[model samples]
Target chain A: MKSIITEPMIPKPFRIHRKLKETHDTYTIELESTNGADGFPFSAGQFNMLYIFGVGEVPISISSDPSMPKMLKHTARSVGTVTKALLNLRRGDILGVRGPFGSHWPVEEAVGNDVVIVAGGIGLAPMRPVLYSFISHRDKYGKIILLYGARTPEDLLYKKELELWRGRFDLEVKVIVDSASGNWRGNVGVVTTLIPRIQFDPLHTVAMICGPEVMMRYTLKELQNCGIKNENIFVSMERNMKCGICLCGHCQFGPKFVCKDGPVFCYDHIKELFGKREI
Target chain B: MNIAILECDHLQILLDVLRKRGYQVIGPTLGEGAIVYSDLNSTANLPIGWTDEQDGGTYRLKKRNDKALFGYTVGPHSWKKYLLPSELRLWKIKRNGVSFQIVTENEATRKFAFVGVRSCDIHAISVQDKVFMNGQYIDQHYTSQRKDTFIVAVNCGKAGGTCFCVSMNTGPKATFGFDLAMTEIIEGKNHYFLVETGTELGAEIFREIPHKQANEKEKCAADDILRKTAEQMGRSMDTSNIKDLFYRNHEHPRWNNVAERCLTCANCTMVCPTCFCTTVEDVTDLMSEHAERWRKLDSCFTMDFSYIHGGSVRASTKSRYRHWITHKLATWIDQFGTSGCVGCGRCITWCPVAIDITEEVHAIRESETVIGKQKTIVKEDIHANTGTLSGRTSFFKRP
Candidate 1:
């Protein structure tokens, strides 16, 4: 038992400044680091391992854009025990933040091309940064098309931002639901329906999609059918990310680490992983 | 490099010398119903005349004709039992009311000199090194245990029934990762160890020991014996295109076929030296004020390992087995830059069912085309490209 001492892993404290309920089960938490006034930096589509005092830790994506560095926002749905505990936290509660891990949307790569943003349910969280990046640099791209779908009208997230984007002529926003009530006046079909409505030159277009595996897979097929090359389409995948770094074997999808290699990957890079189940 | 010959009579004296030099010499000793690694003070404590006959789920010690100290290839246990301990306390947390402060225990400090390390064990250590140390998140516990350890590697004089180190390109002769390597050459009245120094410390040890320089005849004998052991390997895996095979055959029925027999007892993981999956647990006292955080080794074979919202992602045994096998043989190349398995054969020997990895690969290869037929039926209506969300989107909305 040789004692080879190295650097100690210290947990940094972050205070929950605000909480917003986007939907019934989903909530957005805005946190500020207690250690330094300078908040933790994170790109959209990257996640942080949030640790609760009594409960354990879980990986949650940073939903806010990189421009807002002072406050970190994580839009998470209450899925498991750890997330349930996280949603119970009121304003001014303390939590541990580990990383702003994984690759972000290639906004720089899609600078001069038609950018098509597709999101389903809570999947919109990871794409929020890329959306903001596009808005700030609106003149950089050609056509900006956003196709977002939720389970229901009530399940739709970022309604305020969606409303704001609807007023912009540079952006085209189409919102759909899987199932709708009698009072629902929006599109009443799958997200794939909206893909045909957006007109863009496929060869000069770069699409970024984030959603349920089923939804993303279908959307990817639609994008390909519409002439979007595999390399031009980027997708963010989900996995059980224990360690945000590449060590823990949980987030492994084939050779790629969803936490490190991607939460964002070219469709060509992970086309094989999408072929298999529980990769 | 130097070679030294130590007689069987002077073995205890050599052990004592090593012990006096501040080395916690650990070797085979009788412990817990089998020969296991333990602190040894003398040569008499070694399993001198003991050899093991090992197979799937069966291991028994048998008496050998020669009184050889290092005759056995390997047992169920490897050096990893100590280096990457089965159970470890990662961190402790104490709560005073609502506020909790985590107190980490200082890691143990002591220099260890493992005496009878086999080549496969060295490979196992290297495999674990890639997982624990070479990554962005270094495992402090494994790093601490491995840093100051000295190794005395022993070349295999005999091959076990479950041995396949040769096929994995790991064994028969100690290649690297050891301070010193020894080959025991005992013919008739001649009983001595031909020791070779691999490191400066090993050269220092060689300087202390009395021995004659090895001639060409002795070197040839050592080489011949190692070659013989390599040829005598009990199993061999066709590693060529193994990653590709697993990647391409995702729908292979062999997974489901093997899953029926696999009990998911996790014995394979327990014996595997490189399996480093862990789950964190939080324990609270009756008072509820005191809590402790423990990190325990976990296996993908368990249903709870893939637990997400509502249920487990891999609820069936077939999926779990597929995850482990693919991750080890195929996806590991992408993650760790090498295969996860070192071909130690401990997983094969320890598994309750004789689920040999070599056989499983062959089974998948042979049934690939037939498996494709089953795939068509198994394919959900969800477009192959999109996955399984075909007509279900409309049902997601509630009244």
Candidate 2:
């Protein structure tokens, strides 16, 4: 077998600079450019095919905002074979990155409109870039609200960032836990409960929601009940994507390829597909 | 295109002419209890006076009353078994310290000429071309093998028990995408083959064969034979608004009923001529310096086919089967601009449960009508504006 010398479409063997724990089961790793190569170019919601030498490859969304240059960050949970190997990586280990594949959150379209960010568990990783865009250009939007939920208080991610956003006068941050213990004092319900407590013009709001399939379905239904248009709602879909390109045919939902046509699609565009249990 | 006649006595001369052209001729031969596609050097190697009876996961060989070389409808083997292949080497990887380099190889270069190809198999090859060669990311191996191949298509003289190509608008008669097409007709004490050239290369071959031009009676006989084959089809799928019918019946109970019997054995996809899903596996040698990457055929019916971060998204057999059938019949048109199935009947003939797609679609249509009638009777009492508010509110409000 001969290696065809084509131009590299993705980054290879990027060195990890630091690893930080977001939760007991989750960790965020920061990667630096190897061989003095430029950092991978990617949109916020797009993901990378991270490969370990002997293990395998898995798709992980970029957690760090795109505004940060020369470094890439990914928040991963210890899930399968490839991911378990990724979690064992140290500060100076290397891994392969083959994307920034899939459609990104439409930050430019949400410009000048009230932005509602809803996330559950590790789903917040994909929304991190859009959140940074909002925080950096806070004057360009109307009102900004963030509603996030996790299994427990200790399971919450981005603890420092949540505290910083809570102290800001221009932003609203609401955190929820599915079940609570004695030490917790914040709201103890699902993230959808906080949507009704906040006040915003449904006509002027553009929502970016990422979560489990069941949670996103229920939240979209709740948003429609609040008079939000389907076009104004965006959701991220997770599937078994083998080839980040569209050749493998694993991640097809009806006519669209989740890896190519979307990972982020407007509710109006995919309503019929989402109606069924699986397509 | 020119039509020429090849008398039954001159069949051996035509095979010798093809053999002298430096092309490996492959056709139907007796192998493993049934007729299979294999290399042939002479006319004697062909399955003369032999035919096959095919059903779901069952095939049997029977002797015909007359010595006709091209009388069968189809067999378990299609052209894809040779062209696309079951397994292929994708690339080789070598690790140097912390970095890895991938090497892709070119393995196929031989020229082949396939004889006695059925019309449905030709359609299946055309459908695969849209996927492997016509797309943006071209599969180099498939392109290399298919580029220099010669196809001699044959019109079907009989229909199998599982044949349904007429309903899918694929075939019963060979129309195009072949270098040469022929229809064999046998009468009392006389046999002649009606041949037509589709390309310049086919014309060259026709000139080499000693034959007379086809008359009007021979053309009429060929058409009549094709019409009879179409009429004798064992099954038919309604193509009118089929995509919309499947879309509306996604939640119908018929899917649940079918899932109970589906074993998900994946034989249908394995035998299908156009199913092109593949999975990659990397193996490293004991030295750890050399690694080989292999691409193997994969199917949607497998549990790991839809494996995600947490688990399989399609955990139930019903959802997996629905995904395969709906994608093949409906959504594939939107994806690749053609239906995934060419109506080769391989799926029906190879499935362990004998799950006929035409039967499944009819069941869904009937169940949908029943469900529609039941819903209409309940519509008067149902509140359209503000019904189920409490249930919805409670489900969303739960912690």
Candidate 3:
């Protein structure tokens, strides 16, 4: 029998170490454990429930590298009440940290295969961990490619990191925008439009995706058209979650609870209900 | 285990014994024009000589010809109101400037002895066990309250107007999960209770009460009441292939029909004995000095239940109804390895619009041929709308 913690609902206090403005509305906040606990070890595509005191909690994906778990981090857009509260946090401001919950991307499983990571808008936050995992274990895979897109040139996240990865000779990083206003001399369209330009052995490739449901749906079709098997593709999902431990039932996606069974799932398993209305 | 027959007048002795054992006895009582479950300090508190008349969107308490303490069926209040609690203080926080320490709640101490629990409700408790107690992440309050709690199960002597435990194969007879199972038999001039001990604790408690060794005739009489209750079931459900039926008929037009009538008031979920969905609330003073987090009962029928940054996923009434019933009967099995419903029929009796779930499922099953034709049309429409990938935003439109 699995022995549960006496109080799973109670969160350990974590103080904000640093905050970075990623976009016009999004911010990434780094945190430190208040009690000097060990590093909060976690994998790619997992999310944490960040509780803003006196307000509420929201589930944000871990954006920092898994290799640097001590510098815990989460990226969120100021969309709702709790997220807006999250954006208002400054250095040393304390908040509650519940998890590093849900299933993670299969980086270990994709060690021998070519890796293709696709992200859109704020969705890049969740995929950043996967890219870091790939870089840390570069010799394990054949080829690594990153295809990221956003609403506009200004909406792209992790601008400095993208440029640094672009300079690397071993990795290929391609960025896109739906509509450009500045002197942008790059591919411009939806993220799926960039998928056709990349080259990887579909028979031995694993495509990882993290984005809004609509973007992921179109991307799935484009990746499948490139001969990538449904089983080889993975996607991260989001829903209204209250208890990140799967008790709240708000994050149910079809037969599975997105909080527990996934925030990351194999495309083949959820293909039937992925794009179905209101599911 | 032991079986005994106690006279009706001596029923007070059972309550007295349980109270002395440090249990807060809770049972059915007449309140708000219905037989509601509440704290029972004495035998007079039980709704004796009272039987409830239940049907779709209706419930009325009527006088019974015989004085049977456990005559009424389940009411709006379920055992969940005590076990899971409508509102629970999960934890409290004391803010000191920019940083604070986590403070856990006091340990739970009150032990409860639930009396007059029906057979179907006994099954409901076991169903919730999978969600709260027997899972990887256990609810702390649930584990504490349920640890040493006692259950007194009563076999139904007659069926309610909306009861269908026989259809779900849950009850009419309390076969297990009870400390004591009793069948109230009111023969001519002889009103006694044939009680059987189900556990060591039950046998110990049974020894403290006034009783006589029940003969074979008395045991057979108890079985006869359960048999009669089973035959008088007011409703029935087809359980075979239920999960597949729901998945195949997700887009069935019957959902729209039910939506037009469903108020989305969440009455069905509130009355359901096994619906365990919840949402949390954070409260604090104006100074933000002290903060508290409370877990409140939530339902899938509400528009806010599925809210995200953009909006509620299941925005339409039809989709909300589809999510609820389908989750209760189909996906819940896939999730928890068993159906969420125990066929208690409280949901049917409490709905304001009288939307019958069994009727809706029957409607879908009666017209399963519509599945192929409807699915094909929707698939064709999606294909036509988006001739190519990335041409359309969403292939699946709002229902």
- Give the best candidate by lDDT: 3
Better of 1 and 3 by lDDT: 3
Identify the runs in model 3 with alpha carbons over 4 angstroms from their true place. A1-3, B369-399
**A120-184 in candidate 3: lDDT tens per residue?**
89999999998998998899998999999999988999999999999999999999999997699
- Going through the candidates in order, their DockQ values are 0.23, 0.29, 0.60
Candidate 2 C-alpha lDDT tens digits along B1-399: 688888877877766777788778888888888778999888898889998787755677899999999877677678888777777766676777766676667564777889998888888888888876765456667778898788888888998878889998888888999998988898877788889889998889778888998899888988898899999887788777878888877886767777888999988888788888877666778887777756678899999988887688788999888988888888888888888877778788778778888778777765566556546645743745333323222211111
For candidate 1, write residues B286-352 as lDDT tens digits: 7756556676778888877777555667788888888888888988887778888777788888888
Point out the worst 10-residue segment of candidate 3 chain B by lDDT. B390-399
What ranking of all candidate models by lDDT puts the best one first? 3, 2, 1
Task: Sort candidate 1 into its docking category.
Answer: acceptable
Per-candidate chain B TM: 0.88, 0.90, 0.92
Q: Please tell me which predicted candidate would have the highest TM-score against the true structure.
A: 3
lDDT tens readout by residue for model 3, B36-121? 88999888989989999999999999999887888878899999999888998888898877787667789556889999999899
lDDT of 3 at A146: 97
Give me the displacement of residue B245 in model 1, in angstroms. Answer: 2.4
Model 3 alpha-carbon miss at residue A194, Å: 0.9
